[model samples]
Target: MEFKYSDNDQLSVSSTREKIQEEVFNAKCRVLTEIRECGQLCDVQIRVGEESFPTHRVILSASSPYFRAMFTNSQFVDPNQQVIQLEQVSADTIRSIIRYAYTQQCDISTENVESLLVAADYFNIVGLLSECCQFLASQLSAENCIGIEKFASWYACSELEQIAHNFFMENFVEIYRTSEEFLHLEPENLCRVIASDDLNVKSEEIAFDAIIHWVDFDPIGRTCYMAKLLGCLRLGLFSTYFFVEKVKEHRYVKDNTACRPLIIETLKFLCDLDRYADARSLGNFDISSCMLTPRMPHGILFVFGGWNVNSPTNIIETYDIRSDSWMSCQTAESDYRAYHGTCVLDGLIYIIGGFDGMEYFNSVICFDPVKQIWLEVAPMYSKRCYVSAVILGGHIYAMGGSDGHTRQSTAERYDKNRNQWSFIQPMHQQRSDASATILDGNIYICGGFDGVTILNSAEFYTPEIDQWTLITPMLTPRSGIRVLTYKNTIYAIGGFNGVIRLNTIERYNEKSKAWEPGPEMSTARSNFAIEILDDTIYAMGGFNGHSTISSVEYFDIDNEQWYGAADLNVRRSALSACVLKGLPNAKSYVPSRSRVPIMDASDTVHLKDT
Candidate 1:
């Protein structure tokens, strides 16, 4: 026998289920209110200091494992006992904990969270303890992170400890300089923080200063561990000027007998860079742990130039992938320009021509993150808007774009030695709003609009031959698209195909000499910025035909799925982005573009200017 239902029966059944849920919710609210107001059915009295709380044993037992064990275990205290004395917890904390037991809600504030956490931990109230930890974790900053980390570590709250630890590492320099908590860190904790390679301080000079300050805080008590702490600082990262002028003559360094040999060895290593290898082998210290490296593997992604809702914006922001946070860069007044072409060379970012709402630009600017300065570079041969630029063979190649009047087939290259731009062999077809990337020593440029129509045509410039060679066209004609090289394959991401905004993506495999369909993006975006970090391609901020979007998403190569990342601070379109490696002040070097075996397409097509 089978049961069947009509449309009316199904509706009636759904209505009944919703009604039952509402009634159950109402009953729960009534029971919680009665427990708070009447307290007539409370079977147990919890005494803390001079105050006593009336609560039911069943609610307490259900809310906490410690209470459950105390009430249920025959070998422990009897469940029939009328009152239980809690000597460790305070009266206010006990009341808050009991109130949470009955209502599953309690106020957690800066003043009360610590005491509540202690009582919650003692009673094995995991939920309440978690709430307290989360509240404290959110309140973490440069000033309070050290204390929170220590507290979380002592209480065995691993999640909270990690959160506080990350904050401390990210802001080590400022915290060491300003936080009173930093001066109070225990020797072991201080050593651990100093030893971490993830510290984001500008130089080892700050680390050395931090060590000195710690010792000076309690000289007699910390003097014995001076050598141990000094061993953890990356002294090699400090400049010779700092070592000779500041550190060498410090009373702490000169007075400490055990630390003298370490200082001498560091100076010797600095004098003869080759001696670093030998010193590492001879010294018992872990050399790798004391070496300075990038805090983030692929560095940070800089998002530059885009149109806000009302108009073009010169705002520049950097996204820290590790922290999943955005920070504004201290850019110069001239740095406010959008719709520009961007490429990273010699650890420097080059911003090329674009429209800034009022005037089109042919000017170029170079940003040296290490120096934290932006310098106006040699202007391009012709003013271009919607251009694409890429670095190949130590020279930056500016590809086709509109000069605000005509779509140009002309290309140019910049010579760093002369600090000038010179015209190069022009493309066969005039195009604008295209994208370019370098692979196998050749520059690949793909899909954009000619003066008449959108294009699917693709081509490459061979430096050896010094000529542009046309390649297989894309599956769909698109302009304002973003192309990225990853894992030896080229991905063309989302774009507008003249009629509609597209989320479609495609990839080019050189071995097959063909374009293959790839995964589509979550949003149909155009003129967005795209960057590849650690094999994942992030698509951020673009126009979806009707409006600019601040949303960002990434495609995981291994999983073959798209997931959302943090949104930008402002909605934007026609933005540019690139990854910069290492902290500022580290030695500058061009980052190698290596790839794992993965293919992804998350392009941004150009939407026709409204």
Candidate 2:
């Protein structure tokens, strides 16, 4: 295929090559000029197949976007120094990024990530940098994150650093923990990383020490100690020793480590559960010291579980609206348990399964306030503790519960007439200490423990198919959280965050199928009780991080917020409550602990209805 070269052909080929080289040279000059003259730091260059952006341009522009943007118009350039390789990003992607840079509202497709990131970092566009950081965090991977690591470090992107910390924390054991590459990271950053499996505590300690020393050199104190602490707690590496060491030296924490009177007041308030008779001011209604209960009974308000002292009682008390007092109606027909579930149907108070210190009970028992007797019904197939139960469509649905050792996904239904237990489809996730409530023909379950971890995911039960369908997860992962339905929406309130109790509240929108952030409780807690009266959702006693609270408060669901309410008389959890369907008597309706049956004395006492 050899042919003699003609002078005209030779000149034409030479001219084409020179023209290509000239275009490359011009792109390089544009990037350098933007950086040196315009103060735009970007490494923009054209990338052609198998070609390298000139070495001079690579060195001069380095990681800046100015040099990278030159390739926006040229289809042919060097590949190695393109900033984003020609093979990876399409021409349209580059165009979109260029558009986004000039106009704030332009849509930048995901394919333009590299160019946008380079531009964001190089130009010092803080807003764009944060947005890119968030976007990158969402699509993070070991491969992609590795490439972006150097850029993140060069630009001092604290947000990206946190994002990396979270990603590593969740996937450390699976992807990065054993890798030599990640193992070489600074001790502090290493500590910030998370692993779902087991934490490398010793490695974390080493990193934490290094960070403390390095942070000492930081005068402005930009380092995030709280974020690091949360990371440690999430990874299950936090302990009394870690807390002592960190709290003693960290600058972020408040000086007062000792408990105050307010703390005690908070504990009292949470322990009150839903008995708000004694509440005078917001101060007494301490909002902090309790966890949210998965089981919250309507109308009953506070149903006192047996005391927590050495002599725990099997007594289950109910707060009656007509009486306005707390009284132990009768010992639970089943076992003496804390964290048991109680729900009221018709005139009977149903105390479902819970733990009795040694064992979890699936036994279902009902008590009649009028008959003054407890009757045992069919027991659930699986024994559960820290469980939640809800009545939907005239049937009782029992969700997740622990077997005193492991969480159970299995659920069951109780037929009122037949007095028997039947199995229902299990939930997607096994969770104990979760909350369930009826809303719009669906039972919404939120926040619970699955033996090893707290869950943020939620699901709904459709009575039509008798199946559980997954829904959007809550914003926070929690266990021992309580949920209530008011105004057709479900409110999730107060729960343990493993490290401490929380006061954060959120709700589920049936129409949207999403959880929206809601008002935070005055006191952080778990194992608390929430009830709705009129327009207000009352949050009663439960345990906070350090202790229990007698605090009570209410939230205006319609307003999407909360405010303090009257405190309860006693600090109690694991109580039962029911809306007082007041008898048609002439008078004498006061809130009390004992529930009076809606029937008259002449009504027959059927064992099934007890």
Mark the 10 consecutive residues where model 2 has the least summed lDDT. 601-610
Count of steric clashes across candidates, in order: 5, 86
Off by over 4 Å in 1: 1-298, 330-334, 585-610
TM-score of 1: 0.50
The number of residue pairs in model 2 that clash at the backbone is 86
Error of 1 at 147 (Å): 36
Residue 447's lDDT within candidate 2 is 81
State, as a TM-score between 0 and 1, how close model 2 is to the true structure: 0.45
**RMSD, candidate 1, Å:** 21.6
Model 1: lowest-lDDT 10 consecutive positions: 592-601
**Whose TM-score is greatest here?**
1
Q: What local distance difference test score does each model get?
A: 0.79, 0.57
Q: Which stretches of candidate 2 lie over 4 Å from their true place?
A: 1-302, 306-335, 558-566, 583-610
